[model samples]
Target chain A: MAANNEFVGGKVMTTLYQHGTLALLVPGLFTGTQTVGELLKHGDTGIGTLEGLDGELIIMDGIVYQVNAMGQVRVVNADETVPFANVHKAHPQPKIAVEDASSDALKQIALKELKTENLFAAIRVDGEFSQMHTRAVLPQTKPYPTLAATAEGQHEFNATNIKGTIIGYFSPVIYAGAVAAGFHLHFLSEDHVMGGHILDFDLAKGNLQIETFDNFNLHLPVHDPDFLETKINAKQAMRDIAKAEN
Target chain B: MAANNEFVGGKVMTTLYQHGTLALLVPGLFTGTQTVGELLKHGDTGIGTLEGLDGELIIMDGIVYQVNAMGQVRVVNADETVPFANVHKAHPQPKIAVEDASSDALKQIALKELKTENLFAAIRVDGEFSQMHTRAVLPQTKPYPTLAATAEGQHEFNATNIKGTIIGYFSPVIYAGAVAAGFHLHFLSEDHVMGGHILDFDLAKGNLQIETFDNFNLHLPVHDPDFLETKINAKQAMRDIAKAEN
Candidate 1:
């Protein structure tokens, strides 16, 4: 059943479809078994990392894009693979106008207005940002390093006075290891030239759309041998991966 | 998509469909929002608890049965609601012959033979048992007490030289709060005369069938105001509810 099906009465349910776990990636299990094309079938809006943990992934309007470590943006091929991702079918929700909201401010607004503390919330913001901080990791070769180590060499940049859409998900603390515990957001500019894993941002003025999901579909990888053999220490990974706090 | 759809090749995917979270029940929220009829639509077999913490629920062969505090067996009404449940469509798997195995041994075999430590595992055993220990709680009226407090008054019994089926699920440690971290099982007699939440068992020889799932569907209830307002402390519940450990 879709996300809305979890509730009674006539309502549009949106399932938060996720492929792979952040825990697997923490231990350097970067090889992907699910392709981009297959992931798009589950949702139109989402965020994740590409195969090899090459770059940040942004899915908007059913199109997949990759933001490289050098802050380069490119449309990823449909056949390209992904190591981890979270996606959902976007249903139209009433947009609330937000002014000069910080990252934490947005979280508070969602909790106070949408009442999404216990549930998973899908958020989208379309407007100009006063400042945006983001980072992306380089593609690794065979014998991939742990995500924490990979993140150490990430390319961080600042984009000011830019128009973009914020795509993100808020996971409950219970899913800390399986996914990032809190807000994990990514940004994509209108020009499709700037986008990456968002570190921080100041929304000048934006129309914030929030959708709460009552269902979560965690799709794990079966083909990857590392995923099977690895004793995932996600709690350890969560402690080590500081960037996961985004 | 079905559980098998998560994998690339043609392997029957078994999706572990769960309604409500173990965390929600921690704070004494025993109101059933999802009906038994609604739960069975997602899967044919499962285990759960009834509203008001009435009894242990066992779903086998598409039939729902409740074992009360007195260890009495009765068919649950289709409209009867459950506070928590885990179910999956059973795709026939090669059964492994297990002989004179304890509860821990069954887990070991599942790990060695089925390799289910990292994945969600659905296990079923049909055979005779030398010793079977189980417990069930009485139905609580409104103004329900917390699960830990209700578990204190549980009725425990021992059944020796009995034939029954063990229905259970193994959740990874990452899901400790949402579901039991380890094996959570329920037992039902072949004659449908005896059944309850399993504490321990000694199987003489049985056909142990295990289905590993790559997908986990966590369906949350939206109608329950308690679920929305309550700050669920599942970690606290996990520490207090000793019966959660099988």
Candidate 2:
């Protein structure tokens, strides 16, 4: 039953939080028969099955948890012996603690991890023949004005400014006969210092060209050559992963 | 066909966007048969019908527009004239007006907009409920330092620190035999000084909760009383409109 929905099976990409905690979406792991606690104890190595709403079993990391009709995550694998450990236990609880942090703090931490992992480039399919790409980087200085004591002892500061460039690519995929086959790509080259976590993206840029196919063109920035290389590498990795899983 | 979907048959909501603009999904809008150009021409007074993927025909103004499998828009009303007043026109060619402007200039503009718009408050959804509920205020002093002196100063200046407060609610609709019929709600209250758009909202909060229901209770940031009132008012207006149409 789980094999029917071939598109539903995929590895959960892990993202780290400011406190050094991890979070990832485990697709097709909700079977409604076990709690998140139970699933965590089952370990991550074995293939677990979840019963989908359509009555199909979804193969996942051998663990089952329940998610309500709404897409919010209810339970997580909370086993005691799991590797990397859930650092959320000591505070007001993992979810609450992380959720309560400043967005800037969280973003900084997340981006730092992504840079360390070299997963900073983002790519999306725009149409059959095009792809959009961008990167995140850390600014050497802040964008806002600093507060300084005046002669009379008054202090003042102002907002910071930041900019990100979105570069697009026209690929050979457009000639594949599909009405639309393109991708949107982004790279987090600038570090977002506020969130404490590096920016992680969930993409939907690949399907954009179906509506704007006629307006296809490449807009190269001054850093285009290097950015293009990163885009190509990212796209290749994505294709390889898709092929391997299929 | 349009009359069947409306109460007395002539009123319908129309969304307008300029051609070439991205037709962003607005949750309730039926994506079928709605095109960017067509929506712009829908006009302040015109009759048209829109059909969703579910085959449910939503009266556009007074007539129905047939939607194709590709989500293209086709006008069905021969007599209704769609005005061109609100149509958004895109530049026929890319214009590089700021070829020499540093990235820092752009960043500063972005930050100014964010500050004026009070985006920081809107992004801080995880803070305490009271803090979240309070309207966003532009700080008299800038929080971060400036990068305007650096080569990438403009780029850094545009990155902003915006915050939002996510609020949840459950409202009872009607009392039934053994169950109480009600809907769950989530919303976000945004305060920005630029446009004076202080949204006291319930629908926004309700919508957020619905989308994030799984992790609702665990996330912090309490709901605002005033904003909740506004949301309730909005919900009532929607209910009235829905009822009148039926």
Candidate 3:
């Protein structure tokens, strides 16, 4: 199995490609510099947000989709820019049936099934959801406020008896500032009518697929003065991220 | 200046390629899987150690050199394995001159000159040192001890009026567990006769060259059981790293 993919010492080495830090996003460094076109070059599946906290983004099957504050889903333009994202090449992994599980239960399942508690893993869940609760922030103009502030004004969307896919990445506690520690997930309904940053969900029945990542390619925004000039306090930023993301 | 290298929004982005995490090292996970030949494919210059924490490694001008526990420097073979390393392609950058400066003084100059307090940067210093203090650990067998314990048995070497180069990296506080926060440097004499992990140094005169990195490619060893099964405690590992490296 290791020899099937890119191998290093006969071990499959899958990379989780990340753009911009969650710490940068907490302080509202929302200027989009990397285009959706450029991001696809690295990997095909992931999640993130557009510039100015425009919407919740889902990259599936090499296509970019955005779920806006008004609960409208649209196929994002190739030239559209993204402020932050986590993408990776998808591969076949063992699957497990998850029934009547909450968000926390899903995390526990990941920990037990994947054995990636200390390492990074990319997770995907596909099936029917009894309840899905999500939110998306309205696009902001120049001089954006902190993400926590933006999240407070975010619009919530709820759906019941819906079929969709959940995409997210699991980061270890040590990488809290660079990426959100633990499961950070986003949802996209099957019909492309409902999707956003997932706040909570009750999985009625879903097949959980997970791939462990051995490499992390962290790309920073060095050109943006806002990124370089801002004094990012890791501890404070982690707190802000927890508030906003949760 | 940004246009001279790979540009994203008019900013030059150089990358630092790292194999294995410092946290893995503190716990004494010292099985070398990545070969030196394979590592050089990512960058030309860097610092790290051989398998089993055998010695201090200094990579310069695309050559891999290892300073043994007895302070003997020798060119490493292409197939020699590396347990941990940090490497990047050398690029031209503005230079600064330092005379009569300590290790702390060198760090201050880097912070002032590079303006990379929140970002990662690669630093190099070449010149004569009035005094140099360094150490290297002997090779360990199976069931290696913790790095802090190994540091106790490390062989320390000191020299005066020597010409050498300092190679190191500056990682932000947020990345303390992944990489050591602040400056982590290693020394190699101009004659390639005396070099090791730097404990302290007094520079008589040296020209400093610094390059800011916008990307960090961290590769982990997935096949090694020590890497996969070990439960790494970030906080404890950090304390141990400080004791060993300092």
Candidate 4:
């Protein structure tokens, strides 16, 4: 299924040397019935020798050494196993946080714009909105209100469509589940920053999409406070640096 | 990393269905805010609704539907999820009595041949090894044994390297451990049969290598067993059936 050696069927058996050095052994070969003496003569050049038992051993090139009877050999370079204490250990700091506009700041901006307009509509960062963290602009046409009002009215609004852009940054994370989680962004500019909770993840693509929720029929404006601030600050910093260099 | 999707610098979201169904939806363009009611009046049909509580309805084209707060939509057709149950629950048959050829039977055959020669081998018919089940003949090499002692002073009896061919049938099984254990056969004539236990099986390539303790070396004969057996047995059966018909 996945292009990994574990799932596909190919394993290498290796001998762990006492010096913390390891050797790459032949893949899928076994040391059967042969004694320690006999195994030594099988052309192994490694410093280790087979223990006196019926267990398995790894014979890479010519060197032969004992392995756990039950263990299967992995086909990787000798140095690969050095960092792995065991094959199953989890990685530390497995996720990287990507910067994004704050949700609260975006809501504040949206609420301010609504108040200025004297509109009574409620505003929220709708997680249910598909464009919440994407470059995709909200669709021009609205179907929900039409469906709510009448079946015939729904059809008319579908003719002309509205579109807006959602923009944000993405963070990366390690996947421990059978089904991988999609990528999400850290709201770096938000007053109440949310971190480490999975949002808008995709397993297959192994990426995250981040954007503002300014599009669609919602009452929010195209400008998000944090995003606007980041853009302005970036532009100002670039100008100041250029003047200093001059 | 596996080159399945195009690389994008944003958050990635993917939806996977039970039976190999996958969909990728991304945010695009939104021009201005329109109520769900206003957008639905356009009479377009690209809109879809998700099923759940707090479901916010989405309008695409002329259609309107709700998306639950969870940001998940189950768009799978009814027929798709059925085959997943069958594939997940399947289990192969286990080994049983007829499948069990005792170690004693192998020992008896080995002992009988060892009386005349230093080593003896036999391949038996059962399980996956039966000709009725698998017709594929695996490539096998002869065991290279080291010289132990001299037969006579003048003439040295060198340790012979013997490789065998597919003559009859034999089913191999793992006895003490997860490793495979069994013997392969090389036919000599109509009455004489020889084989040995296989020490290595390559599941990926379907190749088998057997290690026999005897000195006799054999290869597969030119005579086809199926043709010969059919000619001999079909004659008698055909005659009996003819008489019954008469």
- Strongest candidate by TM-score: 1
Candidate 3 clash pair list: none
Q: Pick the candidate with the highest DockQ.
A: 1
TM-score of the second chain of model 2 compared to its true counterpart: 0.16
* Tens-place lDDT digits, model 4, residues A164-208: 112121110111010011221211112111111112321111112
Q: How do the residues B1-246 of candidate 3 rate in per-residue lDDT, one tens digit apiece?
A: 112125546755687888988888887898997999988887888999999998999999999899999999999999999889999988877778899999888889888886757778988999999999999889888898888888888999999999999998888877777888888889999999999999999999999999888788787787787787788786788788777777
Report the CA-based lDDT of candidate 3 relative to the real structure: 0.86
TM-score of chain B of 4: 0.14
Candidate 2, residue B207: Cα displacement in angstroms equals: 34
TM-score of each: 0.95, 0.16, 0.92, 0.14
The model with the greater lDDT, 1 or 2, is: 1
Clashing pairs in 1: A4-A13, A4-A14, B3-B13, B4-B13
Tell me the spans in candidate 1 whose CA falls farther than 4 Å from its real position.
Answer: A1-9, A241-243, B1-11, B241-243
Once fitted onto the true fold, the runs of candidate 4 whose alpha carbons sit more than 4 angstroms away are: A1-88, A93-97, A101-246, B1-95, B99-130, B133-246
Interface RMSD of each: 4.2, 25.9, 7.1, 35.9
Candidate 2 stretches with Cα past 4 Å from truth are A1-5, A8-33, A37-246, B1-28, B33-246
Worst 10 residues of 3 chain A by lDDT: A1-10
lDDT of 3 by residue, A118-155 (tens): 67888999999999999998998888998888988899
**lDDT of residue A12 for candidate 4:** 21
Better of 2 and 3 by DockQ: 3
Kindly report the docking quality category of candidate 1: acceptable
RMSD of each: 2.3, 26.6, 3.6, 34.1
Candidate scoring better on TM-score of 3 and 4: 3
Q: Order of candidates by lDDT, top first?
A: 3, 1, 2, 4
